[model samples]
Target: MSAAPKGNGARAARTRGPVHVIGAGLLGASVGLGLRERGIDVTLEDLSPTTVALAADYGAGRVRTAADPAPAIVIVATPPDVAADAVERALTSFPSAVVTDVTSVKLAPLLELTRRGVDLTNYVGSHPMAGRERGGAIMARADLFVARPWVICRDEATPAEALTLVEGVALDLGGVLIEMTPEEHDRSVGLVSHLPQVVSSLLAARLVPATEQAIGLAGGGLRDTTRIAASDPELWMQILGANREPVVELLDAFGADIAAFADALRDPAQTGAKRRIADLLAAGNRGVGRIPGKHGSSERFTTITVLIDDTPGQLGLLLTELGELGINMEDLRLEHSPGAQIGFAEIAVLPEVAERAITDLVERGWRTL
Candidate 1:
């Protein structure tokens, strides 16, 4: 939990200004689009003229050409290496305005800015913990940040007005605010964000030489595990490079875990080896428990799988029937088989609704796999 910077809510409200979203990438465009939808004036900018134009065309905001006036709140959403420079440019471009960023690692960028004697008062650091594996403005969604934790890093010199302005933009975009120190943000993300990218990429990279038959056999588990491997390499390089130390530390720990897991598998001692592997798996299960439950509740889900044709309208029809049944789906995934018309759709619901949903769907001529 973070204490609000010393300021009255009324005073902070009065100081709000037009939000300028820089970079025009997915994260930036999403923020701009969401804010613009709230009737807030938003200006968008990107180094590439085409990107800026496309993002504006996508309803992010009006393009901030050179002739436009300086914006009130400037958000730098560029790569990690360029983020501090972008923030400096924003501050220079809009002297009286608040400035922040959507970069993952904060400490390195903050340190870089500090070395240049930049005005820290009007600048705060922010990282919205939401993104897609895809990149660019075209993948932007107005609700990308909805209900996600948007972490803000503030120092003593950071102005209350500046921090509040950023939080206001976050709230307007339907995000919950979280705060931490710059170093804390960097270390935490190195584990949660950076490490996952590296691990997923490593896993996916191994499939390059896999036989077509083997690759074709991949299912939901493999897809879910390696989904982040589809992320933009250029952007990830910058992020991982900037947060190298903490990421390296985490990688070392993960490497040790992997070695232990391997040793457990190779060991001939039956009981002890099985116990070792069980302990590692139990640790993983406990870690997963720390993650927020569906809709923020602790209740477990009961999953029901329905097999259907893989043709068009089949998925929609199934969902329509469930909708008409007034049965809410907690989670669902389609498992399509290769060279087969039928696919299994796994649907998750509340435990009490699970058996009932299965029975109803099956009674309606849908196959429950």
Candidate 2:
């Protein structure tokens, strides 16, 4: 297990009593598992008894009992549809506790609570930007939030002690903390997270009526673009609905961009048509370049593709050889043809070592592309 970061911020807000997690789903279970790793007491609850039991079985935490004292922290990890209700209940149920949530949309729940005239002093909103396409207690992992951004939505009225407690839990679970208001957080995610999910789903939906021949020509670009389209639609419906205003605004802007690109592509003979297309494409390159690398920095690497047999041990042997060569791989991806006996292993390495790594692999009888 990894050690929780030691510092005044983290130390000041150490968990005093059992940390109660409502909704034993992926995020809840992951929180429990991570805290348990740090020897903190965690108690779990869920609408479904089976889910709570399963998470407990997976080492997340045990079910809460009536005899247990009021918790020091309450993490509501329910679905977005019921997130506001859960947060309200948590705040009322544990009046002295610092209540926080892992809901995707921040504004809706906060507004809902305000509409209900619920006291919000003890509540803080948070979103851990880490999840699998698939979710549930079965998919929970202690290190799920490691190196991931965890946004904390705090208002001026929010107490410092409450904020500190929430940040401590996030840091203890290996998340990089970011502070943002509910409005700022919602608008930001509408562009980065929600927009991508919608675009990916729309792109993948096109494949439904595609000819087999056309589908067979798919490559890494198609896979990378549509990967998140496999996410649960029912879950997305709640998220999209909760953050409807911002997402709709984003969709309108993106649609206009798409229309502009289509117009340019359809009339290449027009003045600056080709230039418009190139500029749009170049803008995409710049946007991608801004995405942070492994530890929140913009660094680029070179990728080398090696051809290998489809046999089970072939890929393992190739990786073993690379280790022996003392070459560190930054990333690895595999691509295979449907009926082919060979596949490609794309290995990312530092740009300075790419040539030497390629030469070594080629000398070891590996073919490169």
Itemize residue pairs with steric clashes in candidate 1: none
1-369, model 2: which lDDT tens digit per residue? Answer: 246533222544355558999999899999998888777889999999999999999989999999988899999999999999999899888999999999999999999999999999999899999888899999898878877899999989999999999998998888899999999999999998999999999999999999999999998789979999999999999999999999999999999999999999999999999999999999998998897773322134688899999987999999999999999897788889989999999898878898999999999999999
- Can you give the lDDT of residue 158 in candidate 1? 77
List TM-score per model, in order: 0.83, 0.84
Per-model RMSD to reference: 6.4, 4.5
lDDT of 1 by residue, 115-149 (tens): 99987788988999888888889989777786778
Best by lDDT: 2
Top model number, TM-score = 2
